[model samples]
Target: MGWTDGYIAVDWGTTNRRAYLIDGAGHCIDEFEDGMGILSVPDGGFPNAVSEIRQRLGDRPLLLAGMIGSNRGWHEAPYVPCPADIDDLVKGLVRAGDHEAIVPGVSFIGDGRADVMRGEEVQLLGAAAAGLLEPEALVCHPGTHNKWALLRQGRIHDFRTVMTGELFSLLKGHSILADLLQGEVEPNDTFKEAVRHSIAQQALPADLFAVRARVLLGQARKEDAASWTSGLLIGCDVHIGLARSSDPQVHVMGRPELTRLYATAIKEAGREAIELDGEQCFLAGIHEIARRIDG
Candidate 1:
């Protein structure tokens, strides 16, 4: 006999929780989302959120990833040692609540150093299945905390985190520029001009006096200032990320629009970029987690 049933895959992050009803073949049937991130949960909120998801889907096997498996989450699943292959991940599975099905984050400890990932880790594995991984490759995942990782021989070697989004938000909301450009004016040539200016320098100068003064002196459009600000920041980020090597295989994973913009910039700098579907990658992570756990 064959099994015919639905399973739930949940990617619960810090500010949001999303659940999908998937079949045995990893096809999504129904989906639901709520603002139930670990950060928003108020003591024992995990159980409540899990119950809500269960009620919506009825009785089904459940798998999860993201901060929900962190120490600050409902339950902390210890890290699965890395460079963990399939066997390691399978051995680390843990339930979400009661007999409710759930898989935990895998941890890797090597070289006297330790690292951890929740959901995205599994997603990366799925993307790599696209056959982009080789003996040497770089994967960049952009978001609030942009993650750049190095993979070799089918194993994640190391990674770095950048606070680009958070830094940009803080500057725009709390800096002097906030007062100067509160209401919508219009972003004109100033933004593109900023991109050109930043890209030209090869390295951004510490002094940003010119960025504002140019606008104040009527040299640049006031409305375009924000866009220019955005370009400069993003450009610098690209420059820094590509600083180490000229590897031809650069896989970018993130929001489509932003990734497209980054890809454009990268191409202009004579580099080709392969984009990974963010949503699919998220779902793929759950599937990969389940596979690893089952294996």
Candidate 2:
């Protein structure tokens, strides 16, 4: 199929950026990725960056999501409050440079705290449109900052953010736990065991020291510490998400490896989990937005 008639959809985050050239039929024709995230862009350079990308991919209509729409991004797009649907998101789109637009993030204020998310809203919209999301569904988008969202009647009811991934990184790189971890950790029996432990105990700070003690006492290998730590954090995230949700089943969106880990943890908690491809959901959401804009 001729892909030259496609528009560009970009998922521009803090550390990296991904762009998809999608055809009129909503199929991705070409894709590109780069390390030039919002944080990397120099002041007043976003327009030039867009021009450079356009030169590589042609001057198609560009729609951006994620941190690229934040106050630190090319242009700040104010957040659309929660209980927002596809239509609300579509209406909230903010125009940028010529032929460019930024999707607004979603915000929730409740329980004496406020939460916000950007790129995941597109994924949620795609999931809802594809019939993958049920009424009153609990959707988990696992990443650096894991997002647990509640969807009611095709609208995002509320959500919570867990910095599990970020915390894991800090522990593995900066904390005393770093000394015990060796190499990349895979999701294995040790990981599962840690998940079960976290779920059962429901106390992370109290258990973290046990990891170090286990390694020092030769009860657990240093090589297994990373996986163990990963499991504990993920398990805690899932446990908290489930406890806050009234729904029994969860819809998880992420890469296969990450989602598998989350699914394993959810299953260990005796809850149901359905995995959805993150990229696909984002593309579908972009297509949906494009359609609504065109109409």
Candidate 3:
């Protein structure tokens, strides 16, 4: 999946987007990110949006990933089923024209359940294609909707989504404990303690109320509520993710700070944590796709 030719790769999401210009030397000659997400574009404005993006990056062939391929994006790139690889993604590419296309999302259905992911497929399969992941690895991508993907023989075998980040957002913004949980969530003793309680109990709804009650009862500081709530949610997340398989080491891919937090939570639950930069993985995945397309 190593690519040397030049191209423009866009990871378009809900609130922001980033575009990279890769050159013949395999270096990012130029790059920029802005708030031109799918939600920011006006009705029927995607054509203009694409122009704006290309103007910033280059006239190189456009390859868009993330939510830009969703039903709400420029074109609805259907999901490729699990046990997929880079070829599956390239085959699923929804082209608008020659050399202009949107990378599709990935879907998994089984055990009477269903799940889907858009921007993450690139990273998941990218990690594999770049040889950063093992054949029997359990990968964790933490975000608004955290994804835990099971890789079997270097293909995305199956995956599940956890809403821990969104839950924390709701709790910190709209929930009854909003005011109490406003402190910075450091990876301190409080966070680890909350994670342990959550993983052992695995009852997050019941655990969240403790954030308010503990503060009110003077048993815990309100300043610690944010960390506590984060731990509670992520603890439950790790608990369930680990239950899927006995994968002892969890490869967490994301921003350094966020990945560190998840790593702490994972380690607290008696598992190993390996952190990978999210942007690096994305670029690796994009390069893999670009190789398949331009080669």
Candidate 4:
């Protein structure tokens, strides 16, 4: 009665792809990773990539999520609107190829804007199924474009995106701050202090130039600028997300490093933060969908 009794789960994104093979007991028997992301696949190359993986893992049914379901992927799966649960996702699955299905992303229209998420919906569903998500919760998924979703009764109600990570990358790699943050600096009181300042001030554009100013004034070291900038951007994101929600608890889902930063920022904001493994939530979400379909 296990959900993934005869299927493999694929979380394909822009830069990397991960595949998990689950047995009848819902245990992952094998896993694979590669640089075969959407960006790496050329014209009509998805089938070849799938074939390569299938050759090694056997021709089990494929359940795909993430950018693989977008317009740039093998097949375009239309997004299902918010207030959706695992059942809605199961109903929205679109056929991509022989014995392969793509989970539809989720879309939300609120605050006079339209936002959509592809793979994170699966993670959210998985978190809900795993009993990690509370009945009413504010979930944060930190990445290039961090997502803050509102969950009510185990269904996604609304969400928003913050380009904090992408902005940090642009600043550290191409902007004026690049020279100051050319190297890494471990997080310290400086970083935490920056987070507190940014959250308290809520003035990012005005404060960003301070990274260079502090270095020029000998108030902060050039090496520490990276950590300071990271804290500022993440703090701004967390501040904004928390401001938008009345929920007192925050669920953070992402890599350990990123989640650690988010948890710190959330704590600085006087809210409780719970960390959840992104991979576990993603696989659980695929299984949740499959379970509903099988029933």
- All candidates' lDDT scores? 0.66, 0.88, 0.88, 0.87
Query: Residue 164 of model 4: what lDDT?
Result: 92
lDDT of 3 by residue, 123-224 (tens): 988887777888789999999999999999888999999998889899889989989877888989999999999988878898888778888899998788
Candidate 3, residue 154: Cα displacement in angstroms equals 0.5
Kindly list the per-residue Cα lDDT of model 4 for residues 1-295, writing each as its tens digit. 2345567889999989999887766778889998888999999899998888778777788889999999999999999999989999999999876578899999999779899998999999799988988768899999989999999899999989899988988997899888877676445787788889998898899789988998899998887888888888888998889976877789999887889889888888899999999999997888887766668
Clashes of each: 9, 0, 0, 0
143 Cα displacement, candidate 3 (Å): 0.2
- lDDT for 82 (candidate 2): 89
Error in Å for residue 165 of model 1: 1.1
Candidate with the greatest lDDT versus the true structure: 3
Q: Give lDDT for model 2.
A: 0.88
Taking all chains together, each candidate's TM-score versus the true structure is 0.82, 0.95, 0.97, 0.95
Question: Once superposed on the true structure, which residue ranges of model 3 sit more than 4 Å away at CA?
Answer: 1-5
Which regions of candidate 4 are displaced past 4 Å? 1-4, 185-187
lDDT: which is higher, 1 or 3? 3
Ranking by lDDT: 3, 2, 4, 1
Worst 10 residues of 3 by lDDT: 1-10
Best by TM-score: 3
Could you tell me the lDDT of residue 93 within candidate 3? 96
User: With candidate 1 superimposed using the best TM-score fit, by how many Å does residue 181's alpha carbon deviate from the native?
Assistant: 6.8
